[model samples]
Target: MSAELRRELSRLDTLANALDSQFRIPGIGMRIGWDGILGLVPGVGDAVTLLPAAYLLYKGHRLGARRMTLMQMALNSGIDLAIGAVPLLGDLFDIGFKANKRNVALLRRDIEARIEEVA
Candidate 1:
């Protein structure tokens, strides 16, 4: 696939978490949310987050992301899955943590580092 397409896929990879919570709270633009609600759906909630993450991994591979970076992505998803599988703890975990946001952050940081290396 083309680089642009990979980039777009990467963008989509972060959406599962997006639907779970409003990155920034509505109207006021606050950066908190009711993300814990997604955890109630059990399998689907976690799957919702996983699919996008997998897309990210696939696109990241296509884009030549380092093995370490890909591993980091896997770790991120694993943690998300682990934390999201519990009962009340999982809901609280989702509310407090945004793994998808963090993964996207990782990808952006990786891209910047790669650019610096090229320069």
Candidate 2:
């Protein structure tokens, strides 16, 4: 991959980490991040989280991710938003789901496959 692409991927990885798994709960070996914390709020919390998710999708599109790959990313975020709007269960689900990480993984896989194809 080009240096720019590498940097972009790194950025996405960092963003995903921040959104999905930035902190570990003491003595529990479980990690969570802003996504889960924000999910604690009512309707606004889920909506707020959607902004970063949308940015992920937008960056994936700019990176030339395939249509199907983009769709999958959207689906992941959609699921996250839909289910993550619930009460306590949604926060738990957000912690476990890690949708941002999943989307980043999908974007990385798509980019790597494209690079392989070109090479």
Best by lDDT: 2
lDDT string, candidate 1, 1-119, tens digits: 45875566466544635644556656965453333455678767766657766876786677677889889988977887788888778866776667766666677677768878988
| Clash pairs, model 1 backbone | none
lDDT of 2 by residue, 92-116 (tens): 9999999999999999999999999
Global Cα lDDT for candidate 1: 0.67
- Report the error of model 2 at residue 19, Å: 0.4
Q: How much does candidate 1 score in TM-score?
A: 0.72
Score every model by TM-score: 0.72, 0.98
List pairs with backbone clashes in candidate 2: none
Candidate 2's C-alpha runs over 4 A off are none
- Cα-lDDT of candidate 2: 0.97
Model 2 C-alpha RMSD vs. true structure (Å) is 0.5
Model 2 clash count equals: 0
Q: Which consecutive 10 residues in model 1 have the weakest lDDT in total?
A: 29-38
